[model samples]
Target: MTIRDTVIRTLAHTNWRLALPALVLTCGSLIVQAASEDPEVVVPTASPTTAAINPAGVVTPAPGTAADAASGVVKAPIAAVAPPTAPQAPAPVDEPLMKLPVNARHMLVIDDTGRVLMAKDADTVVPIASLTKLMTAMVVLDAGQDMNEEIRIEDADVDRLKHSRSRVRVGATMTREAALELALISSENRAASALARHFPGGLAAYEAAVAAKIRALGLTHTSLADPTGLSPANTSTAAEVARIAAAAARYPAIARISSDKSSAVEINGRPRELRNTNHLVGAKGWDIRLSKTGYTEEAGRCLAMRMKSGGQTITVILLDADGSAQRLRDAAAIRKSLAKIAAA
Candidate 1:
């Protein structure tokens, strides 16, 4: 062939090759759109046993091909192109570490050395309901009152502010020791009020002593209006309440009477059984050295405990929990979080 004829043949082949892909793509798109718009029309997909297409865009059936044997029609495989992906949201900045799973409105966990391990709103002052008995017991013990001396619960001992129910009736009489147990363990309001009334100089003197004891403990955010803790005016911060737990833990009677699971004492000439207000005191898996629980409409649920965990004495103060179960759950969550920290 002449050189011009050979060049013309090569140009025609190149143009055909370039046009073939566009023709195939257009046909495939039309087939897909047709199948979608009219479901009755079947779009044949390539089968492994069908004839294959060559670079020249012609179907060449291999030996024993089903499509070649059945008919002259053979489908070409559609090119697989992935759909464009959406831009990701910058991978979320690695997400700041999750906070502890404590739900108490005020929470504080401190080591024996008074180092705060975790806290939330610990400095906010809030009403501390029956926890006032801890201070009452402390001041009464500090005064060196005769624990065996008999004190009778009177009408004055009846809680008028909250009108809280109590098993320790107004006519009941018990030793100061029994009264202390009733106050701290059962959270008996009348028993607590009787103890304050029988103080060396009565309720006024007891209030003065509580103020002095608060100052002595170096607590900056604690105030008590009554010994029974029924008044909403009795308030303290979670941090200061932890301090109070620590101070109260120092007293052997306060620790023992408060932590005792149950105590039997003579009242109204009959033996009465009083169980602790804080159920965790003797509960399994707990090593509570001292425990106190408090509640009121204004205070919600409050808990204070000096307990041993991971071989370290910890003071856990949870204030303003919604319920008893929630307070206990918050304590358990704290323990679990502490365990994770210890392991880490």
Candidate 2:
């Protein structure tokens, strides 16, 4: 082809590339506008199957799926909405290249390379306290249950394990989305119980689901008895806690909400402020992506955090700490020591 012809073709190709995104954006805007209009148009949302959920909260199969042909999922009277389960990353390989001592009885720090940078009694099984909520969030999100489903706090969720008090009082109402947020962000025992209670087969089924998930994730040394870590039975090793933290950070919902400095939700028709259990989330220069704090007489003050700062990602697990302040100090010391090792 002649140079002039080739140049013209190149320009046309460039124009197509430039215009395609603009065209898509314009069409997307129009569709959004249509959806946003008063008496909003009913747009059938697509899922893994050809099924669609109606605005009136009914599940109907789209035109030609097998479900439509059989009218199976449609006439069931109840819809099964499962969360898309994201596969877990394989367990990290142990690299005992460096050892750093900390106050905690069990501690672990894993880097993005899946290397155990530092560890102390990481395999000792101990009660994880609220860190169990990390697994709870994972199990719930893996179920892909309707996030908008309303969950009412009941006396059943009154933390029979530890009798912990929650800012979200019983008899208050909120969505599963908010419940999950409250569970992970604030480590609310009631929210955790409510999530398990509202699971397909109730708390028992939720426990089974969590167990199945643990098996699936290959957590041989980690198993939880309840949704909340209040029970001493909710136990795991520091190594496994690191793995759980890694898995939690992978989910956008868990990663996003767990790291939030603060969240606001309507409880009993009044705005309630929920603070993150991990105070490191709000500290300057500490790019924590996921955090959970737990404390019980058995679990002591425990902390699990996934930090992404200065382009480095590391998971910190501290269990059975003496006090909350001491746990924070250990974390800071660990980070400092890790930084020095990395610099060397």
Candidate 3:
């Protein structure tokens, strides 16, 4: 069957939850095969692209978006969905997109007054990488389990889907709070996995809550398949990502943990220093309140930060930057430029 027809049949015939991996596999295989046959086609990576997956865990691309070319979902880009009008907060005073470094698929800068200083592709949906953990942390907190409760990492927490390795071992145990701290501070996939595994009913339940929270928060474009963001299906737009950064900053622990430069933690009875994934957090003259960085061959490099500069606070989001260094450079440039602008 064709990718589109297979997807249609998967939706109509089987339990969608179980069919996602198959869908991702088939679609990715087909796309790669086609790309190899066409010499002119330049696929970024031979592995199936993350955009090859979606909320349903299926490889069908949401038409017209970046993922379309990857997953073979050929169609016009979907128009922006206008949400029901509500009491409008004053829009942030608009500013122009200043000179920015390349490799950014989407970028947004929103200031304290709700002014959008600069934005590009803010509405474009894309894979968010481990930024999904911010919501995972929130959901874990919402469950109201004792942060001090003890939990152990297991084989299941290992990234079987991606086969990504982890510093936290299969049998090591720690307080739920520690796992959470590691998740936010270091973007540890195993830490995130363990946190979800320890959730009331476990990872499946945690994932369900994540989906619910996305809908509840009116994050219309965000979709999460797993807590660790190992699943390429974990996706969101730059606009929704900024909103998530704001909400995540509201949690004292999230704000504190994410902004901490580094912390010492014990895993497998050995002391290890867990450092913030976003280097801008500790860079001189930069005041980051909450930050998270994520990267995968599929999603590229991503960053979300609530930065405080002078008297103004802004959420700066960069998604799918070409490399780690480029994303940081883009952020630092933004801060310096904005600070100069505000001073003037």
Model 2: CA > 4 A from native:
1-99, 342-344
| TM-score sort, best first | 3, 1, 2
Once model 3 is optimally superposed onto the true structure by TM-score, how far is the C-alpha of residue 161 displaced, in angstroms?
A: 2.4
Cα lDDT, all candidates? 0.76, 0.74, 0.76
How close is every model to the real structure, measured as TM-score?
A: 0.71, 0.70, 0.72
Clashing pairs in 1: none
Note the clash tally of each candidate: 0, 3, 4
Q: Judge candidate 3 against the unseen true structure and give its global Cα lDDT, from 0 to 1.
A: 0.76
lDDT of 3 by residue, 1-344 (tens): 56788789887887899888988998899888877989886433221111122232112222233453323222233458888777644322213233344357787776765555555566778899999999999999989999888788888888888888687878898888889988998888988988988889977788788888777666778888888887888988877887777777778888899999999876655678988888878888988889999887778899999888768787888889999999988887788778877776
Better candidate number, 1 or 3, judged by TM-score: 3
| Total clashing pairs in model 3 | 4
RMSD of 2: 23.3
lDDT of 2 by residue, 1-344 (tens): 44345445555767877766655665666667656874855433222122222232112222333332122111212357989889765433222223344678877666665554555666678899889998888888888899988889999899765667778777999999999988988888899989989988888888898988787666787868788888888888876777677777778998899899999977776777889878889798688888889999999999988887436787788888899899989888877776655565
